[model samples]
Target: MLKDLLQTNASFEEELLEEINSLGKIVDFKSNDILIDLNEQIKGMPLLINGAIKILREDYNEGELLLYFLEKGDVCAMTMACCLGKKQSKIRAIAETDGQLIMIPISKMDEWLAKYPSWRKFVFESYNNRLDEMLFAIDNLAFNDMNQRVKNYLLDVATINKGRKIIKTHQEIANELNTSRVVISRILKALENDNILKLHRNEITIL
Candidate 1:
């Protein structure tokens, strides 16, 4: 279900899948695999077939910040950096789970762009959409308080799971929101006391 949402559209059926299967190799990665490093030259595109991956930047002193997460059927948006001919990536990608990706050469993608303009447009839109998401995250961090930020993060995750709640550790939630597990625990306790949410072993349910 989540996978379908990531791959949404007819172009995957009409163009992407067949073309990918024809030329590229499907590569597998274990959890924590570094798909690309900061300052590395832009390669080609990777079509994620399974599992999840995160793209973020690690500053020498400022620490790490998440940029995005690409799950099953989600194409790597960094490929668009390559499309735009960017020299180096500002973000690095790491596998959040063991996964497989269809690797396509930039040269081949250029050929496809020339052959299928509509497919190219779809790919471009995917990148732009990702850019929008990044901007939103930045806005949240800049304007929202830590409590509101954490609350909003949980709400977003719940909405993503269709309001069923998220089954993840406090540390995981903290990592996603770029905060401390202790902080998250305190916040959760406050919310629980207010009868607003319930916490299980590692999950949270909105009440």
Candidate 2:
């Protein structure tokens, strides 16, 4: 899997691949598994080999808001940050599906940074991309109304699932969006009334 995924990337040269294969270990998680909790110590950086992981931020009130997703071939920038800075994670990472990943030790980060130019480039690029995604999330919350947000959220879910039917309850959507279940139900009902979606028990079908 690593060979197929990393071989095409310009950054992963033969030497780098050898190092990664030798130093990294395979890890797996089931769907909905909490890969990392808020304030947990970062042990290593994870390179996703398959499946998806949802990265979330939690507030003081214990509300979780989606930050971004790490899909196949993507790395968790926040994890990299925590590993390099020796800080605890401020966000939560959960497996969106059963997944496999390669874990690279934090101790070798600096050594790899000095030894491989490609590693530095990959890290910086990942950081910048993640920052952009967070900014987009903030913009959606600050600028969009609840209706628009709900609509966008549904669209995102459909895209992620690659299907028109979303198998989730109103309460589940509310929890992820950090909104009240009542609000989500109202918005979903309104969308249903508008012929935009059909909501049934624990499920929603986009129309």
Question: What are the C-alpha RMSDs, in order, of all predicted structures?
Answer: 4.0, 1.7
Number of the top lDDT candidate:
2
TM-score of each: 0.75, 0.93
lDDT per model vs. reference: 0.73, 0.86
In the range 1-207, model 2's lDDT, one tens digit per residue, is 567854323457678888889999889899889999999999988888887788999988999898888877788888888999999998899987788888989999988888888887878788888889889889999999989988888887787777899888898889889999999999999999999999889999999
The digit string of per-residue lDDT tens for model 1 on 5-119 reads 3354425444555666666777889977999778877766777777777777776754666676776656656656664585687777888668788777776766677777665
Q: Pull out the clashing pairs in model 2.
A: none
Best by TM-score: 2
* Model 2, runs deviating above 4 Å: 5-10
Q: Model 2 residue 43 lDDT?
A: 90
